[model samples]
Target: MVYLDNNATTRLDDAVLQAMLPFLKDEYGNASSTQHRMGRKANEAIQKARIQIAQSLSASDPSEIFFTSGATEAINWALKGVAERYTSLGNHIITSQTEHPAVLQTCAQLQKRGFEITYLPVGRDGLINLEDLKSSIAEKTILVCLMAANNETGVINPIADVANICQERNVLFLCDATQYIGKTDTVNLQNIPIDLLCVSAHKFHGPKGIGALYIRRKRQPIQLETMIAGGQQEKGFRGGTYSVHNIVGMGEAIAHSAETDWRSIANKRDYLEQELAEKLKHVAINGEQHDRLCNTSSITIKHVLSSELMSQIPDIAISSGSACATGTRDPSHVLLAMGLSPDDAKCTIRISLSKYTTDGEIEQTIEAIVAAVHKIRSNSPTWMLFEKGLLD
Candidate 1:
């Protein structure tokens, strides 16, 4: 099977699995219980993983990184933590309409609790206007939540500009870097000044059920209330039995990513897009005019139902949209926010790549997609109507 849905998750790397095997078997120990040798070993592993993740993001120190279940939990921690601590100063938060359900749902919850949320709009290219963000910030605005890369379209946000604007306005900036991690190096704290950033290990070929949140604490230490109330783990921020094996896997994945030639993924992605455009007509790539992640392609084929095309190419693993939002009748909120009609949104399919993706795989997938589009459109009544000038 051709798996082109890396954005949903990646196959666990062999190196990462090997590193985690020892912890999963004989090295089982509670990281918090450092009295015994096994426990001490686990604690050391956790710290080493912390440093690995910290250095990967160019963070100032390892203490700023907090482990969580996944990026969803980290996102909740960041948004709700800021709301709990900074409500006295302000109750407004600014974010984009194209944000993930994690961010959008968390912000919606905040709104129900009396916070004002301004969801900035994106143009057809799926990018938030920096000026709108600047104008949205009020004295009551305490934080601005934006994503580094869109999960659906792969359109990159101007995070540096957003961070600069937030810095000038004295508002905290939280970036959801779930799709951005491992694909690029745009989330460096030293360069972007993002107050909070969240990443999932599984996005980068690590194990699932593990994620990290980087909270800025060096120069401008921001205060946030604890989200998980239980123990002294994560420096009293979260409480739970540490998943030592997963953490170790995450570190190994990060280390492995450094050696990968990601530029090759870009080449394959561009080749796939060019081949599709050449073989198929009435096809448009969303966010093509703007900078996007090198490994993602969101294409809309007019009069083509993504559901039908995907059904035709069952062996090829692609997605009609975000995995989290699929299986529902509603169109993608991200595409709608980017000015796509519901019909166009339904016509769009997301094809994401990874280091494991090959030139042959890309070619086969492109041929499959081109043929499937042709087959789907041949049976589509709407295509016939449009061809006969019976409809627009």
Candidate 2:
């Protein structure tokens, strides 16, 4: 099968699995207990993995990093912790409408607590206007939440600008970097002034059920009230027993991202889009006006429903926008926020690549998409009108 839904999750790398086998088999020890030899070894391994994750994001100290179940959990902790900690200062938060459901839903929950949430709108190219963000900050605004890169459209936001604006206003900035962290260099902390960041290891070829959150403690320390309160695990950041094998695998996976030929993958992605677009007419690419991820393409075939096209080509693995949601009638919230009509949103297909995606697979997928779009459009009334030279 041609796997192109990498934004949903990546295939776990073999090298990462190999590095975790020792921990999964014989090195079972509680990371919290370090008096004994086995416990001490596990503790050391976890610390080393933490340092690896920290360095991957260019964090100054490993203490800024802590474990979570995934990006969703980390986002919840950051949002709730920030809102609770700064309630005396303000009850207002700002975010974009195109954020992941984790952020949107958490904001919804916070609304019940009387905290005001402002959702900034994005343009048709899936970018939040910096001017809109600047005007949204008020005396009551205590936090700003945004994503580094959109998952479905793969359009990168202006993080450095967002950080500068938030810093000048003295508001904390929290970024959801789940889809951007290990794939690109934009998540650097020494440069961007992001106070809190969320990441999911599985989004970058690491094991599932493992993620991290970076809390800035230098320059201007960010103090968040502990949300997951229990024992002193994670130095009071989180409360849980360590998943040692998963942590080791995540460390290897993220550290190995530097060795990937991402440029080659980007070329393959561009070639696929060009070939398919030439073969089929009335095709448009979402986020074509802005810089996008090297390995992503959001294609919209007019008069063709993505559900119908995918059903016709069963061998190609792709998503109708957000992780297989286009199969239903409800359009993607991200696409809608980007001003896509419901019909166009339903017609959009997201093809995301990874290091494992080959040139031959991209070529084959291109041919399959061209054939399927033609087949699906042949039945569309609008396509019939276009073929008859009755419509432009």
Q: Name the top TM-score candidate.
A: 1
Report the Cα RMSD per candidate.
1.1, 1.6
Show where candidate 1 strays beyond 4 Å: 218-220
lDDT of 2 by residue, 149-207 (tens): 99998899999999999999999999999988766653789898889999988998999
lDDT scores in order? 0.91, 0.88
Error of 1 at 27 (Å): 0.6
Clashing pairs in 2: none
Please report the candidate that would top lDDT against the real structure: 1
Question: How many Å off is the CA of 103 in candidate 2?
Answer: 0.8
Tell me model 1's lDDT, rounded to 2 decimals.
0.91
